[model samples]
Target: MFQKIFRSYINSFSDLRREVWLLAFITFINRAGTMVIPFLSLYLTKSRGFSLEEVGWILTFFGLGSVAGSWVGGKLVDSIGHYKTMTASLLLSAVLFVLLQFPVSFWSICAGIFLVMLVADAFRPAVFVAISAYSKPENRTRSVTLIRLAINLGFSAGPAVGGLIIANSGYSGLFWVDGITCFLAGLLLLKLLHPKKAKENVKEVNLNPQAVLNDKPYLLFIGAMILFGFIFIQYFSTMPLYYSEVHLLPESDIGLLLGINGFLIFLLEMPLIKYMETKNSSALQNVILGTFLVAISFLVLNLTGWIGALLVGMLFMTIGEMIAFPFSNTFALKRAERGKQGSYMALYSIAFSISHIFGHNSGMQLIGEFGFNLTWYIMVFLGVVACALILWLIRILKKEAVSYSSTPIL
Candidate 1:
């Protein structure tokens, strides 16, 4: 029985190339030291003596920068190529991370965060483009899922280690570790990852970013993604603040709870996603279900304040995330003709950026004004709307589905 399960596990990773695996390793390394930002809210409020409103504005700037970065990176990847964009973003972000560690005022911190988020996240679109370029269509979602597996495994380690680091060496230590790891990842990519890997089939599709914008169905889908992103981001932003403020949980305890999310994703996501893919569930269906699960995850929190309840809610959210994101990414990328992958993926990254901006900033205000329960209630309502929007996108895409009906899908 154990052998059968092990074979099943290995089968989930089949059909991917070496380049895909290499990218996953790079992602794992990059994410492993991503500890500073998760704790940034508490650091700003408790240690830096900023108000929740102030932190909201600060994080909003980060989101704005990420949006800009995604656009720039996507363009650069298409123009100069992914290799240069990937290397530059990582190296530049390393410097930015170090600069952000300096003692600074509110405005200075905001500026630092903006630049850091911009440079740091610029690599995202490039990574997405690379994955699409390197993998076969049949293996696309699996490639994304495997890379996400690396990220989640790293996340599982980063926060737990971050709690200890913050406890011992303070917030500055978090920045130092993050900076060093990012720099190392850049160097490794330059050394091991090849630009040629991302060059496959690029000449086949239109290179214009405008071409992506012209697709009505794709645009609607991107819009829905922003809604999904808004809900998903609360896990990283408002959820922490709410837990710390209401439960009075220590950073270590909060870290543990967050770690559970990554741990669960690492353990269960691949097999679950494989099953869903095998069962031939539509990506839209998966995304809608995932969105609803996330809504339920938050709604359940309203029932009780116990730590156990929060953990259970987190488990639900992680499962939702596992189902929704990889398939959603694959779904969107399917719309891109070959040369437009970078541009398409770049636009896709913007949805999440908007989420970070709107979700974090607005969630802070809502919690401050009305309180946590009401804020969660509103989130549940939005999730319902998001589910509907996704379904609408499905109807729009169905017009074009006839051409794609012959292909095996995620």
Candidate 2:
């Protein structure tokens, strides 16, 4: 049975073998470099010596930069080819990575992180554009899932390696490691995915904002994603602190917890996504249920002290993420017009970047003032709001479905 399933999966990718492998490899390497950033606060405070407020500022700066990058990348993908935009961004990011390794002042570090995020995050929309451009709609969702799997696999390795590097050589080592990996990955993409020029007939599609941003349903979905992102950003910012303060998990154990979360995503996300696909579940329902599970998981974490309990909370959180993310991407792709997939996905990407600018700092401040339990409850409240938005989006989509179905493709 297992062999049969494996064979079936292989058969599904027969046409997309080259594109899938190229994307997978690129995703893995790029994500491996992500390790240097997420753990950056730990590096700053624990190693280079910075305050919590400073960390928040740096993150906020990075977020602001990413917001701009997302927009620019989307537009560039519409105008230029995906390979060109992605290569430029990735190559620039590699240079920025090296700059970040410099033993600079706190202000310099903030500037470096912001610049890197701006340039590096630009690759995100380019990647989504490439996937949409390369694959037929029938295979797009699965292709995205494969890329996500590679991301998780790379992430699993990145943190463990990051932790070990930090433990031995400090934060500088982390940046240097990230720099080397990013440089290598960027070169690989440039060499392998030699992008062709944009076709003239598709130029009209590129001009339509309605294709990406004008629809009511899509806007509603973005609203929901923004709220979801706010709560989710806590995983990086506040969750580690909560573990340290309330649960009394040591620093090493916290790293292990995050590693376990990444590992589970690597192992289970693809299979779970495949299973969900078989069930014909709608995207809206998945978003609602997933956000609910994530919120509930936080509540459980607030009450539990045992490592087992924490792991269980993370399990539920991962489940929620796995369900929501791919479905969200697929839904966005469907909602977008032909050739505007990059713009749509880039708008979706805004959620995380926006969350970083406001979400983490806000949560951290709330925790600083009100305490961990209150902060967790606030996250739950945000999740509830996200659910409401998802439901609203579903209604909007249902209303538009018939109208769109009858309309001629422009």
Candidate 3:
């Protein structure tokens, strides 16, 4: 029954092949491993005896490393091809995971985390770029949605399992399980993905690291994504801490909230994209609405006693996310130069890694002293700022649309 439903959904979309579906499966395994780290700040500071400030710094290092990875990963995709770059990244990341399991000095752990992030971050852009490359132009948004759906599904399951493991077996279990999953993901990539390397001249013609940054419209989109990412990243850091410390909620319930969050994505994302096609909304409009919803979701945390209120807020927040993400990718791809999609996508991803580190580290400090309520207030403010940027992007896009329409058709 499940297989039949899956086939039906795949058939509903154009240009989705067996290979893309297989790649999605591999991405799921890769992300499931990545999910283990979201709880690491809590583990390191609360359970493992690292100072809160130190944990924040370590997280920052990981983020900084990811920024570097995004740039290098883009070049690697052009040079070695997506399949090889992904395979190398996965294998190296698995090795780093094992290295992390050993008892090491704080500086050593920091260094290790940095290296791990550098390699692991490498796989993500290549994966997304490959999705864009393989997908038919008309079905591009749906392809991106499938990638996100895979990520959401992995994240949903991984955290519930991580929470249980942390509760029972501790941090060691999280590391071991995640490490194994990383290796498994690599093996899957090895067997399934065999993309040929770009020819030297074609690679040279298409991939330009500077092209992504220089394109005025694309840069505007990147700025919006960065701001949006900063606001969204608070969930991993500030939101969880709010539940655990400020609200004095049971840890299990926090896990349940995360589970609900993930489940909603798994169920709603692809369907939402399909429905949006019928509604005929512009991608920019969807992005604007989604950011607004995410901002408002933080307001619910102020209601201390009303769990139902919090749930309502989360539902709306998820709605915003479902609308925003797939369209964001589509917009970026649309603006990207022919053959330079990987470079643009990699640069776009850098925004997330950069914002996440900033949000998480800064959020830790805010939550520690000012309390969770104030943190949410701050996050709401950032969300507003992000919305303003998106509005500006809309204006820029309008001018571009008019200009393009005035041009001679091919």
Best by lDDT: 1
In model 1, which range of ten residues has the least summed lDDT?
Answer: 401-410
Off by over 4 Å in 1: 42-53, 163-173, 198-203, 207-210, 240-256, 301-312, 368-371, 408-410
Displacement of residue 150 (Cα, Å) in model 3 is 1.5
The lDDT for every candidate, in the order shown, is: 0.82, 0.76, 0.75
**Tens digit of lDDT per residue, candidate 1, span 284-369?**
78888888998899899999878788888888899889988998888777766533667888899998888877877788789899
**TM-score against native, each model:** 0.88, 0.86, 0.84
Question: What's model 2's lDDT at 162?
Answer: 90
lDDT of 3 by residue, 154-183 (tens): 877787788888888888888888888899
Which segments of candidate 2 are over 4 A away from where they belong? 1-16, 42-49, 163-176, 196-213, 302-308, 402-410
TM-score of 1: 0.88
lDDT value for candidate 1? 0.82
What TM-score would you give candidate 3 relative to the actual structure? 0.84
